[model samples]
Target: MRYLPVLASVAALLATSGVAVASPAKIPVRVVLVTTFELGKDSGDIPGEFQNWVEKLPLSEELPAPGSYHEVLRYNPDLHVIGIVTGEGPAHMASAMTGLVLDPRFDLRKAYFILAGIGGIDPEFGSVGSAVWAPRVINGGLAHLIDPREIPSGWSDGFVPVQGDRPDLEPVPPLHSQWGDMGYTLNPGLVNWAYELTRSVELPDASSLQANRVRYKGFPKAQTPPAVMVGDTLSSETFWVGARMNRWAERWVKYWTENTGTFATTAEEDIAFMQALSAQAKAGRVDINRVLILRTASNYDMPPPTETAASLLKEEANETGFSGFVPSLDSAWRVGSVVVKELALHWEKYENETPENK
Candidate 1:
């Protein structure tokens, strides 16, 4: 007697029995977690923040947004949540966000967006590992660059807003008025509400962060452990590190928000990511008011006066300066998780109505 091959027989039996494999269900994500990049298995490989969230959360679906830099999204159906990484930098973030929002697989209409990432914090505002809620985001990249020596002696930075032919003698109005340049804001109620929710969360700490804070010896805020606060953020393509650069950031945020926005964190992608979100909101695909930008202080934009910017940037021992990424990431997770938990746990109340920011 001749025996049929086991694989073929099994396939035929299964087919005859009408047993078919079922595809995973599509995710209707209610909360979207955004991250810029994550630790690579190798020192420089780069995994993604989505991995950590997926590991912690009960994400079952791995949905693919074909053209996005963070092509895959890990999702949890029961909680209605999804997490994605937009790679790193402005262009990649803009692309990933735009693509994800427009994709047909998921409906993001009622979803709340959370931009959680590491950034350069102004020491005057907070210490490393501090988590901040940005009420406004100003652009620092749309500027004309000049050599510091060539710029007027009174100006702190060589960078000037594009509308002007020269650096301003004093920080003034129309911070970003030249055509495409502009600043962005989050809903005041939403921002304040988020701050109230996360302010009490005990953030992570580190000995290195303590040593780093000592550099800010005189500045009380910078010398303490990380805390959650509300402040504004500035986005720029340049990874600036110096006294002059810090001054530029502080002034730029002040000018753009008409003295309302306080510059707290410095990063490259928040503005780019938000621009896309705002556009989608105009098309009615997203709820702009529900969006939140949360930045954790991974490092300071400049070193203490005792150390020169050049030395901090070039010193072999310093590598990337006094702060570590883990502390900030931990702080961000600890605080951000609370807000997410509130939304998921009380979806009925928050689903159709906006939370009172006050």
Candidate 2:
């Protein structure tokens, strides 16, 4: 409420209780669902059949395009709950999210942002389609605006000094010659909490599966709860080098970053956004004291060009571009549902206890 501006548009906004009867009262947590499409397609290029299935999900609102944040919220007035697309790379992700965060309407103090989408995983630990979590999200794309050559190669080198009063922004000296990694949620308790929530989700038919196969192998009873191997997520402004070999090389940087206290995964927006948020927290301009970023891997960085040569072949064994990877999409959709339901449950609990609101 403190951040709400007296703008004409906001004045016209009818203030609902900000509490939905379908949810628990005074939810201590605000969950945000963020997705991205590096390939610039709609609905994550989910297999057409799988798209149909995801659409049936009882989401509060659905958007027409991947990067169109405004459209997703058109039917849902609960601005606190929203979605964003990182637009081809990190700059777009930064620009769009900066707009949202700076907007007087967004209650940054109470909201937690979750960055969710597909990502490439380490072969031994994560196969395609298997979900990976980034407890330590690294902004691999960030560097001094002036010194382009001063690219931090690992987490220790990239520990940028955010401006303000908060101790969290202390100018951490670059211990290693790389970028710094930011921890979104270090609470091990919450990690286990999230794992238990989705581990039991039944795996769909394996005949059409692609990624996350080994984790859910033998058709085991959802033993992992849709787990994500948490690490540093790398960010790039440019489209991933489209050659498979090149992409593979770039991933080593991701691996090194993650191994050295940063989880390197790729997305366009999070690096700058995190820097801004850390600055704001230090300045007392906003209180993102409990922010959490949860993202699903949509693709691995540096995808092979042979797998997707531009305009070479329109249709393949699979038309939707997901190939046989429908189940991963299903897994993402299922996880989103659980998040929404849990938000509702929190709302319900809060309202039931409020004397006047009840």
Candidate 3:
């Protein structure tokens, strides 16, 4: 989708003006593309790719939000796509979402949301640039927090289950859920349909990414080039790393999903993001089942076998360590674009009707 040059320039103008354009932030739009924080305020970094991509699309409206983290938008009046940047992390996600969803300018009840972001991936399950469709989004932040050293000798990790008194129990609903619903399980049909649509799309790869993937010695899947897959996501405000935390992530997803969902990516905001969506659903603003999350692995959650977590910390902070950042953004947008495009092209079929998983 080619973007209008004016739309690209409008972002700069909005940043300088620190004001909302007179355009409507409220409208019955087709799609609400939700992206998390971009590194630079004015725009730079892989996280900003989604907005950059939107800039290239034909824009009909520029609804700027100087008071908010970012802006609401309009692309292809015909396609009716609007993008929302949920700031970053869980708190930012809730705040930004509340502002956007509750804003009176746009109607969200019929909008299809795609929460796309980069995540720390498990090399055991996927590689950098691999796009994952989350069937279940589990919260890793709101849990029993214990210092690993003080926990029972046999305890798996520092994070204990919120539902049970012990660390190793599956989550039982109506127990400790802050969100009335224990976990946000996306519509199976929507998730499967999304997976099927982009699973075959060829994602870009880089030599640095290849070298990084090669580090996953024993895991063949992580060694492959970027691809799309269906997997679950783990959301924690704590950006954790190490074999221990990685194991906790896997076990947490397993316990929450009852082995039905496999954890592939680790992110910081999906749980809170979805919870807000649930609220909007209750208010008859949006369909909870229409929400979809796509996470691309920007880097592995744990250090490779050859490197110790402590040893790799400094390196992981370097640009070379996150070689997948750019490619992952590419993969996410490329794969996610398919769904966004297909729906926009066939809005008559998808606007009011939820498509089957087929």
Candidate 3 residues 151-250, lDDT tens each?
8877877676665667766445456543343477888899999998888999888887888888878888888888898888988888778888888888
RMSD of each: 6.6, 10.3, 5.6
lDDT of each: 0.77, 0.43, 0.77
Model 3 lDDT on a 0 to 1 scale: 0.77
Give the distance in Å from residue 179's predicted Cα in candidate 2 to where it truly belongs. 7.6
**TM-score list, all predictions:** 0.85, 0.56, 0.87
Candidate 1 lDDT by residue in tens digits, 10-108: 756787799984433334667888888865531234323444566665455666556676566766767878888788889988888888888766688
Order of candidate numbers by TM-score, starting with the best: 3, 1, 2
In model 1, which runs have C-alpha deviations exceeding 4 angstroms? Answer: 1-26, 41-48, 169-180, 315-322
